[model samples]
Target: MPVPELVRPAPPPTRPGLALPRPAAFACTGVLLGLFLVGSTTPSPMYALYQQRWHFSAIVLTEVFAVYAVAILAALLLFGSLSDHVGRRPVLLAAVVVEIVAMAALGFAPNVGWLFAGRVLQGLATGVATSAISGALLDFQPPGSNRGPLVNGVASGVGMAVGSVLAGALVQYAPGPTLTSYLVLIAAFALSLLGVLAMPEPVPHRRPLRDALRPQRPTVPAGRGRTFALLATTMLASWTVGGMFMSLGPSVAKGLVADAPYVVGGLTVAALAGVGGITQLVLSSWSGRRAVRVAAPLMIAGLAGVAASVLVGSAAVFFAAAVVLGVGWGLMFMGGFRMLTGLATPEHRAGTSAMIYVVAYLSASVPSVALGTVSTVFGLTAATLAFAITAAAFSLVAALATLGHR
Candidate 1:
């Protein structure tokens, strides 16, 4: 009797001339991740411009940022595993197309409403593309290799750093602050869309749509509850710091640095992400648990430094703090992800991973708007210090959780 299709795995089929070589395909997946984040963060430096042009308050500014986070979360919840049913390449291509449209919306944005629309579209595109790209990387990994998680973290960090730095420079010196950056991104996405079309599908076997499209709830797999809880806390802590930098770091920098250049604001984010990417690369071979162990203290120290920088009103100190936080961010994510990957069954890995991200992005979203509103009432420095303290508390909790779990 023949075995059922679901019971036996099929051999991977060859696609001569249609598929990229394995190494090249793997590298392209990383590139796609970088580009998606590049689009996601390209709007950061421009927020100041938007505020100046539209006369919106800080509360409104954060709301704009929060909308993207909310949209991304919505997409993840709704279609987290959609690629599993439909295939990775199609979802990736569709996402890039949506990103292109979002870029165009930003380029031509005439009002605050248009900016919100563009942000929402960008969020949806990024949420879709991130899952597919990360999954593709794992599919293409060499046997016994642990490069997938590292690549995922590094690509995102590199993208955030590069996108913010480039956008800031362009906004300062280039003729079109808002329009030019999006134009460049649009061109990049157009090229990426072509690349996605050319790449072969990595996930060969597909499950039924009904099964794959089922609403995903973030849950810790059996026997993984303790580790998952700790890691979730680590993610929440690190992502809160990241969210603060991405959403409000620029404004905070502006308040501190006298006669600051536009690039100064972007520099805060760039420092965190660039240093983070480098740190992850340098420490890629370390065990995930070791990485987390190193990350906890660094997180506390970095938060302390940020608070000090705010009190002293020193850009150098702020930048230094950003660098330290970047290291923590890199290690924290890598460690938690590695641990999560080990604990989850193959069948449940994707959903488990998505749950972690959902938690992290939520951390990035809600507190930032609250900080903005508080800053409006109190002051940027006071608000930053308060936020840093809260983030530190979470980091300490994560540290305790990790220590107890091990």
Candidate 2:
């Protein structure tokens, strides 16, 4: 009997800890990315309401928006690579917690100061999450697939569109408009937190946390200078258009349709962002070079239509122009994102993504503040026209630059 005994085989090793399957994790990460942007733009529809309630000047309103962008920039530069050192789940969890606090601040705000506080907190949370979530997206994407950038572009445009319209509806029809929207966001974010907790760690090899905490300068990947420069130019032009809309599009809508409902203002933003999201989906298979070539002319024409709509006081024209511009915006963003991701390796993915966002938020923030100043001094119409013209000019330059390059 002893001689008949045989050696037992060991069981196969299993991955430690509870985590979602990779496919589910991939989808959840995309939703989380959308949710973060949703939180970021939810306040857009509330700006006019805040100004009406608190009696703040246009400059002050813009300051509120500017503060958020600046906080985002700071967080992006400082904590962008932290997820690469730690894991995606931890960074996302912490950011969501901070976002919940930010939402609470806005939900209960009694004064303009509270608005600033809430926006700053929201910005920090968003900035920190952006690179981490984006990197996680890349990590979870199927092997040999390039769907990550497409997901990023589509999620951002759709999130912004949803946020603007959702907040507008709540503000116009729901009880306690300001408080109610934040309450909904708080609940949504809570659910997202649970999702993050269950998500698997995507970063396989991590560096020490202390080293990754240092501030990082934005850097183009090696030998990617010309491409990076062209992409940066595209970012500057495209995001400037986005910044203007998020900050003042609702107000501009108010001017165009004086008797329109709050939802009309929201729809104005939705037109641009929703259409853009659809365009991204449809054009996902296009090459970056071809996309940009098409984008340049459409952007110029759309901007021109926008200016004319403002002059003629035509809401129809404005909406039409927004649709055209949305297409261009989507193409520009998707193309730039595709090119940028191609330039990055897995190890430096988060850092590389952060660098592009550094360029983006800068364009979004600085020009928005300047446009606000112009609005305060000259009026919203003049400022919008000038902004459109400037954006179109930049788009022209970006297209030419791309064409000249190989």
In model 1, which regions exceed 4 Å deviation? 1-14, 206-210, 223-227
Return the lDDT, model 1, position 95: 92
Relative to the true structure, how large is the alpha-carbon lDDT of every model?
Answer: 0.78, 0.80
Candidate 2 lDDT by residue in tens digits, 50-89 = 8899998777887888889889888878987788788788
**For model 2, where is the 10-residue window of minimal lDDT?**
1-10
Give per-model TM-scores: 0.92, 0.90
Q: In candidate 1, what residue range of length 10 has the lowest lDDT sum?
A: 1-10
lDDT of 1 by residue, 1-406 (tens): 0000010122244355675876777888888888888777778788877888999877778888888888887777677777777888889988989999999999999999999999999888888778677677776667567676668777888888888888888888898888999999989988887778878776667888788667777666887786687768877887788888888888888777766356777787888887888888999988777888888889889989999998887888888888898898778766766665567776776567667667777788888898889877887788899888998888778767767554
Q: What number of backbone clashes does candidate 2 have, counting pairs of residues 3 or more apart or in separate chains? A: 0
lDDT of 2: 0.80
RMSD of 2: 9.0
Q: Tell me the alpha-carbon RMSD of every candidate.
A: 5.1, 9.0
